[model samples]
Target chain A: MQVFASLLAGLVFGLGLIVSGMANPAKVLGFLDLAGAWDPSLAFVMGGAIAVGAIAFFIARNRLVSLLGTPMQLPTSRAIDRRLVGGSLLFGIGWGIAGFCPGPGLVALGMGEVKALVFVVAMLAGMGLWVLFEARAGVSK
Target chain B: MTIAWSTFTPWSALAGGVLIGIAAGMFVLFNGRIAGISGILGGLLKPAKGDAAWRIAFIGGLLIAPLVYALMATLPMPQIDAGYGALILAGLLVGIGTSYGSGCTSGHGVCGLSRLSPRSLVATAMFMAAGFVTVFVIRHLINA
Candidate 1:
């Protein structure tokens, strides 16, 4: 049941990206192009999502287990360290360049975009490198 | 900056955002998880036992979303303007960065903000500022 619900959530999320024009890299770039003619639709998307999500999270704060009786696995880390800032900055640069974050990249790949395939493969390779780095550095992931 | 009034779409964006929120909300409420795309995908790399099914299933559903949308209406065209080299570079950056940060837009941007997490707030702010500066340099400074 949890797995099924996860799938449903993924579908809903993907549809949202499609409907919000977020699945389009060109559109995403338009939002990021702050110095240019800016399309502010992405802000609205963020606003709407946060409004609903905030309430859900507020309710989740008091709950110990989920409806399906699984323990909530919300993140517990609160450290505002170099990794967080540095990684996000790097991610942001990548986003600004291609306007394709992980979610949209996957959505495009699913749509059979060759460009997306290239991007996804490279992204995966990058991720693999991280795993290698962490293992060599004796860092617990 | 001039507002791209001709292209701005507030209503659809809001509607779509609400759907995204609901999906994320449902995952937390019933499934006890965050619907963070990068974290979900990245977790696959480690191949932990009993942890791979839901992630794969969720991604499967995401991949099938286009087919479902196509059944209802014509699929919207995604205009990706980045060249191959740029795309590859961007992909690598995104992959490494999100891993280091431990979240992406969905994780830190959407769900993190929703949780009112101070760490998430900082991450979001950093990423947004970086994005702004990067775009300014690429489109305005470098090309200008």
Candidate 2:
């Protein structure tokens, strides 16, 4: 049931990305191009998502288990440390360069974009490197 | 910044966002999970017992989304201006950063902000700010 829900969630999420103009790197770049002709559409996308998500989260917080009886697994970390800040900065720089974050990258890949193949493969490799480096650092997640 | 009125799609963007939120809502409400793309993909990197199945299932759905969309209507095309070098560089950064940062746009930007997580708030601001600065450098300073 959870697996089915996840698949459904992913499908809907990808459709939303398509519908929201988020799957379009040029449009995403338009939002980030603050010095250029900026598109304010992405802001509305985030706002609309948050408006509905906030309500769902509010209800989620009060629940002990999910509707499918799975354990709630929201993030537990609150530390605004170097990894969080630094990693995000790096990610942002990358996003600005290519306008492909993880989600859109995957969505584009699903659409069979060769460019997205490069991004996704490199992303996986980067994650692999993190695993290797973090393992050496005696950290595991 | 001048408003790009031509491409400003407030209505469609909002509707799509609602669909995304609904998807997220369903995940948390039914499955007790956050629909964060990077985190889910990251988990697949080091598959754990009894955990890898759903992650694969989720990603599989993502991988097949385009075909589904094509069946409904004419698929929209997204422009990719970056070359191979830039694409690879960006991908590596996104992979490492999302792993180290513990989330990406979907996880931290959408779900995290929705849950009012302070950590996500900071992460979101950091990425957005960095995105703004990077774009500034590339477009204005580098004169790309």
Candidate 3:
């Protein structure tokens, strides 16, 4: 039942990505191009998502377990360190260069975009490298 | 600077965002999991016992959604202006960064900010600033 819910959620999320124009690299690039022709549409997308998400999170905060009886597994980290900032900066640069974040990148690949396929493959490789580094550093995810 | 009013579709964007929000909300409420794509995909890389089913289901849903949309209307063709080299480099950076940072746009930007997480706020701001600077450099300075 939980797995079914997740599948349904992913389906809705992917549909949202397509409808919001997030699956299009050009549209994402337009939003990021503040110095050029900026499209504020994506801002509305974020706003709407946050508005609903805020309410849901509020409800989740008061609950000990999920509707399906699983423990609520929200992140508890609060420290703002170098890793967070540096990793975000690098991610942002990559986003600007490719105009493809993980969600949309995966969706694009599913749609048979060749470049997106390349991006997903490369991204997997990068993630593999992180696994190696984590092992060496004795860190667990 | 200037808003691309001609190309902007505020209503659809908002509606779509609502869908995303509801999806995320449902995921957490029912499954007790954050609907973060990168984290979900990363989990697949090193699958644990009894953890692979939902992740595979979620990804399968994402993959199938487009085909369903195609039955109703046309799917937008993604326009990628970057060359293959740049795309590969960008993908690598994003993968590594998200893993280290522990989130991406949907995770940090949407879910984290919604929960009023200080870490998410800082991460979002850093990534946004970095994105702006990178775009500025590439579009104006480097012309790449």
Candidate 4:
């Protein structure tokens, strides 16, 4: 049952990415291009995503337990520290340069674009680097 | 009104994002795990005792989702304009960033922030700002 829901959710996300034109790197690039032929369609996409999320969270808040089983786990950290800032900076720079974030990066791979493949490869490498560094420093994820 | 509604409608990206958020929330409820791509993928890379199953299942689900969608509807292929080198570089950067931050946008921004975590708020802001700056540099400065 949980697996089914997860599958359903993933499908909906993939479809949403497809239908909303988010799978297209050019469209995303257009949204990013504030000064040159700027297109705000991505904003609409982001806005729509937030609306659905708000309602969903509201409903989940009222539920005692999740559809799967346990109560929802929320992050307890309050420190606005370096890891947060540095990560965001890296993520944003990548998005700006490649026009593909993690979610869309996977979806882009489905499109069989060679560039997405490259991005995925590098993304995985970066993950590997982190693991190696963390292992050396005795930190766990 | 038209602009706002169109932007806010479920038919737009907001609806999809909301669904993603809800799914992440529900997954945590049932599985006690955050629906973060980086964490999920990372776990798969270095599996621990009794941790392999869920990670594989999660990634498998990701792959299977599109295949199922293709069977149901015509999946439009996305066009990527960046060169091979640029794409690879971007991916590597994101991977490192996810590790350094301990989460991705979905884990931090959507899931974490929704839970009102200050850490997520800052992370989300950084993600947006980084994206903003990256786009500016690429489109204006590098012209790539």
| Candidate 3 per-residue lDDT over residues B1-144, each given as its tens digit | 798999899999999899889888988899887888888998888879999999998988888878878988988777888789989999999999998888899999989988899999999999888888888899978985
The TM-score of predicted model 3 comes to 0.97
In order, candidate lDDTs are 0.91, 0.91, 0.89, 0.69
Q: Is candidate 2 or candidate 4 better by lDDT?
A: 2
Model 4 chain A poorest 10 in a row by lDDT: A46-55
How close is candidate 2 at the interface, in terms of C-alpha RMSD after superposing the true interface residues?
Answer: 0.8
Give the docking tier of candidate 3.
Answer: high
Question: lDDT, candidate 1, residue A139?
Answer: 89
lDDT string for model 1 (B12-73, tens) is 99998998898889989998898888899989999999999999988887888777888898
DockQ, candidate 4, vs. native dimer: 0.45
Q: What C-alpha lDDT, on a 0 to 100 scale, does residue B92 get in candidate 3?
A: 96
- TM-score of every prediction relative to native: 0.98, 0.98, 0.97, 0.85
Top DockQ hit: 1
**Lowest lDDT block of 10, candidate 3 chain A:** A132-141
Model 2: per-residue Cα lDDT over B108-127, one tens digit each: 99999999999999999999
DockQ of each: 0.87, 0.87, 0.83, 0.45
**Candidate numbers, best lDDT first, in rank order:** 2, 1, 3, 4
Give the least accurate 10-residue stretch of model 3 chain B, judged by summed lDDT.
B59-68
lDDT by residue for model 1 over A1-141, one digit each (tens)? 989999999998888888898999988989999889999999999999999999999999889999999999899999999999999999999989999989888888889999988998988988888999999999856
- Model 4, A34-62: lDDT tens per residue? 66666677665655554555555565666
- Candidate 2 chain B minimal-lDDT segment of 10 residues: B58-67
Candidate 2: segments with Cα more than 4 A from true spot: none
Q: Which regions of candidate 4 fall more than 4 Å away from where they truly are?
A: A1-4, A58-65, A70-72, B1-11
Off by over 4 Å in 1: none
